[model samples]
Target: MFRNIKTYREGALIEDEQIKSYVESFESELLRGISTLSALSIIQRHPDEGIYGYQLLKELEQETGRTLIIEEGTLYPILRKLERDELVVSERKDSGGRPRKYYKLTTKGTELYQHMVGFFSKLLEAITPLMDIEIKLPEKKFIYCPNCTNKIPQEAEVRFCNICGLNIEGLSK
Candidate 1:
């Protein structure tokens, strides 16, 4: 495809293979899936509840129905980065025996989260009508267990995922 384009430009004759490889790499970076939004969503739903690190992992896993791809190596560094940005703050909690660090979003973080939600909602609204599709809200449903992946039928402020054992805001499915 790029072979003909190379000759069309008089001065610069870029090779087809070289151009193809460069374009592919650049596109991959642009399409890489990142979930900073998921983190924001978690904070927004539970503004007052301080979230534990392990709980975040479980929540993400259950919500997406995919492995978070965040292993022992990368989790702490990302947490530190978020904390450094002041979007989230960490504190220690000693409940029964051991101490656990819980993360809570600051006021600025809350506002940012709400803004992101609205922006994405508006974007979806614009795209859907153009595609000739009708968007309908789903009825309320039970929260699925993050570990067991079982659905819990009752409505609660926060529901625990059985599959991964993470607490999540109960939203209408």
Candidate 2:
């Protein structure tokens, strides 16, 4: 027989079922955006020799210190979507006795990855000032627009953001 669920007014302890549901909801919401970007990055890394679904999943886990936990069943649909979007392409190859589908980024995908890198870099930079801990990017000789985070070469003398049209002359001073 199943136990009857009790309310707080009844002074019953919170059930394991309730806690599990809450955790699952929270994790799913948090990973919604991140999972797609992570998958794309994994595919991007194996450009010369494309990687299959299982291998891609393993590499993602290893690269993220096991923090980006994506389910095996969930990865394929994402791959299919990427292929449909023309961001990646896949080919089936005979490996030993089984046909494995390998995925690699297209030219468009590479461009997208670069754009995403800039976006995330700028996003983090904008928020780091408010955080208690300081986060720094690896030493690079590039400058980013404070308004739009558009990266410019250290040697460029541009006074405005090409993307957002924000005047950046003040930052140089």
Candidate 3:
């Protein structure tokens, strides 16, 4: 049916069945308030300075409006794992009256962060257009005749409209 051929909504080109399935199969795959990639990005942005377990929990809560509930128990274990992997380092620091262990990214962590930045950047660039966040601009073209309805190649400066005999007007516009 022509009705089922194509539809546009919210700047997205999606099939009706695809949208129906998405609604029917909605899943909350995002755990820990954000994805692992987002978690690494947060640490990378705040590198150099060490973050205490509780501080990290609070920061995550504040940034995500408590959507990510990072308890110290869950966070400390992750930090320890990172430390063991040599991606991060931790030290007990005394601040006035109390001593707290603080963690910061090590050199290896910095390198990993750089690699992740590039990887995610490329991934986002590729996926953003599909997600409707960005759209690729159409190339300019001049139609040689008005009746032509065929698509012109990217490198072609002029095209002939198959439908009408008149030159397509304002195609490049």
Residue lDDT tens for model 1, 22-73: 8756644432324555665664555676877777777866776643334544
Can you give the lDDT of residue 106 in candidate 2?
A: 97
What is candidate 2's lDDT per residue for 1-173, written digit by digit as tens?
01122244433444466874776678787776678788988998888889899998899888987778787798899889989999899999887799999999999777666556667777776688788657676325556666656655556687876667788674643
By summed lDDT, the worst window of 10 consecutive residues in model 3 runs over 141-150
- In model 2, where do residues sit more than 4 Å from their true spots? 1-20, 139-173
Candidate 3 stretches with Cα past 4 Å from truth are 1-29, 32-35, 45-48, 65-72, 135-173
The ten-residue window of minimal lDDT in model 2 covers 1-10
lDDT of 3 by residue, 1-102 (tens): 122334566645344668756643342233432344445556666676787777777777678776555444666667777788887788899975899887
Residue range with the least summed lDDT across 10 consecutive positions in model 1: 1-10
lDDT of 3 at 166: 47
Question: What Cα-based lDDT does every candidate model obtain?
Answer: 0.58, 0.75, 0.56
Considering every candidate listed, which one attains the maximal lDDT?
A: 2
Candidate 1 stretches greater than 4 Å from native: 1-34, 67-72, 124-173
- Give each prediction's root-mean-square deviation over alpha carbons: 13.0, 7.1, 17.7
Candidate 3 residue 153 C-alpha distance from true site, Å:
36
